[model samples]
Each structure stands twice: as C-alpha cells, then as structure tokens.
Target: MDLEPIWLSIKLAMITTVILLFVGIPVAYWLSRKQSILKLVAEAIITMPLVLPPSVLGFYLLLAFSPNNGFGKWLHQHFSLQLVFSFPGLILASIIYSLPFMISPVKAAFSHLPRSMAEASYMMGKSKTQTFYRVLLPNIKASVFTAAVLTFAHTLGEFGVVLMIGGNIPGETKVASIAIYDAVEMMDYHSANSYALILFAITFIIVISVFVINRNAVKSPFE
Candidate 1:
C-alpha cells in the first residue's frame, strides 16, 4: 500500500483547513452580524454544498475551470495557471465543498454570544477588530476548534468533487478517498480496508474530541 495517497490527503486537508479558518472566520462573523436578504442569499450559497450533490459542484467547477474554455482559458493564457486536474484545483474545490463545515459551527457560536459582549467592548473604546480578537473570539474557542477539525476531517474524505476537479494523479491530487475507491475497483480489498480503517480511526478520534470540547465548553468551571 503506497502511503503517498494518505499523505497527500493529509496535506490537502491541512492546507484547506488553514485557508478556510482565515476565510471562514471573517465571512461567518459578517454573516452573524448582518441581517438582510442579500446576507440570506450569501449564506444560502455558502451552505449549498451541504445539500447539493458533490458531483454537481464538481461538474460546474470543471466547466468553469477547464482550460478548454471560460475563466480557465483566461487564467491559462495569462498566468499559465491550470486549475482543472491539478492539486491547486483540488484545494479550490475542497474549500468550496467543505466551506459550510468550517463556517456553520463558528457562525452558530457567534450568533449565540450575547450582544452585550460587543457593546461592552465598545464602551471600553476597543475597536471592532480588537473586540473580536481580544474579547469575543476567545469565548468561542471550542466552536472554532470544532469547525477546523470538522473541515479537516471532511476534506480527508472528499471524493466526487476531487475526482472531477483533480482527477487521480498519484503523488499529486490522488487523495486517500480516491485511492480507496481505486483500490476497491481493482478488487484490492486489503488496500481499501487499510485506507478506510485509517480514515475511520482518525475521524472517530476527531468526533470524540469535538464532543469532549463541547462538553467542557458548556460545563461550569465551578462545578
């Protein structure tokens, strides 16, 4: 069993999770603070991948980024950047595909926070940025951590979207999930089982950690 696929998955998940952490934080925070039809639409778009089929997102992404036409052609001609069937494309697709996992929990946490927290910070003359980083954000550490872990785990198990955008290029875009599919197709049950079991163990641990974190977060320190 080549470990390359497993390692590639981990690398991709780590990169995707890191990127989403930065991207999701501001987006989630803004969404939490706003209330408008446009914000609702934007939230729906962000949440679309959760309900839509992975193949649907993958297909549209393929069409948009395929070097044969559209934005992909412009990117290729100008920047020499090819997205479809590449590692970078995999990252882009994963970010879109796993965005809600990173955003939803954090957004919910933000929404649940008392409005007075921000008001109190303002009374002390702290800027919104300062209040968010120094005052508000610290209170939702558990949710942020949970969102990051969920995003990482979700990326590790990606299949349809990755298959369409990245294809199965060994040592490149071939992640563990795709590798497992390939193994099963070849009737190599051993390799498939190995990949599945590893993913299972990792995700199980992640879920357990999430539960523990949430439990601790909700538990009173005095108790």
Candidate 2:
C-alpha cells in the first residue's frame, strides 16, 4: 500500500469536516427557522448532492473550475491559485459533496429543539450568536458529532467528483478511493481487497460509534 493516497484522503476528509462545521452550523440554523421560498430553494440545493450522481456534480464543477473558463482564469491570473488538479480543488469538491451529510443532521437537531428556549434566551438579553454558542449549540453535541463523522466518512469514500475534478495524480489527487479503483482496474484484487477492507473497517467504526454514543448520551440541557 502506498499509504500516501490514504493519508491524502484522510487529510481531505479532516479539512472538509472542519470547514463544514463552520459552514453547516449557520446553514442548518437558518434552514431550521426560515419560512421563505428561498429557504426551500436553498434546502433543496443543499440536499441535492445526496441524491444526485457524483458524475453530474463533478462535470459541472469541472467546467466551473477549468482554467480556460472565466472564473477559473480570473483566480489563476489574480492569485495564481489553481483548482483544477490540486488539493484545494479537491477540498472544494469535497465540501460541496459532503455539505448535506453535515447539514441535515444538524438541521434536524435544531428543528427538534424547543423554540421557546431560543425565545427565552433572547428575552434574557443574549444575542443570537452568544445564545447559539453558549446555550443553543452546546446542548446538541450529539448531533454535531454525528454530522462531523458523517461528513468525514462521505468525503473519505468520495470517488467520481474527485476523479472528474482532481483526477488521480498520486500525491496530488489520488485518494484511497481512487487508489482502490485503480487497483481494481488493473485486476489487482488483492490490493483492491486490502483498500476496500480498510475503508469498510474505518466507516463501520465511525457509524457504529455514533449510534453507541447517541444511545448512551443524555438529551441536551437546553432541550
């Protein structure tokens, strides 16, 4: 096993999860409370990746990030930043691909929370930001953990989007999923099995641990 791809995959997942934590919090919070038509549009777009084929999303992203295109060219010209076949590109794709995994659960947790609690916090003179950090968010630690793990796992196993956007360039873009894919394409079943089994074990541990923790944990104090 080269392990470089595996490490790269882990790095992508970690960074994606961290960014989504910040991204998902506000997104989910807004979605949970908003009643506007735009909220529906936003929710549908956010969740589309869950059901959309990775290839479709990847293709659009490829066009959007192509250096020949305006936005991509502007980025390269102004900042010399390349997204087409780089780690930063991989991270961007992973974030969009994994957004729902982080947002949905967090939104569900927030939705299930009592609205009166938020109102009470507001009545007591706490700003929404302060209330979220101190009173609203800390209470939903379980959902937050579940969201992070789900996002990390989703990014770890991502393939098609990564392929179309980043391609398999070894240390540059070849993640574990791409590595296993290459091994299978070469009829290297042994290598494929090794990679597959490792991924299976890691995802299994993550998913099972979430269930175990959720079962044993108490409900949030704010709830």
Point to the candidate with the largest TM-score: 1
Query: What is the Å distance of residue 96 in model 2 from its true position?
Result: 0.5
The digit string of per-residue lDDT tens for model 1 on 36-130 reads 99999999999999999999999999999999889999999999999998999999999999999999999999999999999999999999999
**Candidate 2 TM-score, C-alpha based:** 0.95
The C-alpha local distance difference test score for the whole of candidate 2 amounts to 0.93
lDDT, candidate 2, 68-184, per-residue tens: 898788898899988999999999999999999999999999999998999999999999899999888987899999999999999999999999999989899999999999999
The local distance difference test score of each candidate is 0.95, 0.93
Best by lDDT: 1
How far is 30's C-alpha from truth in model 1 (Å)? 0.5
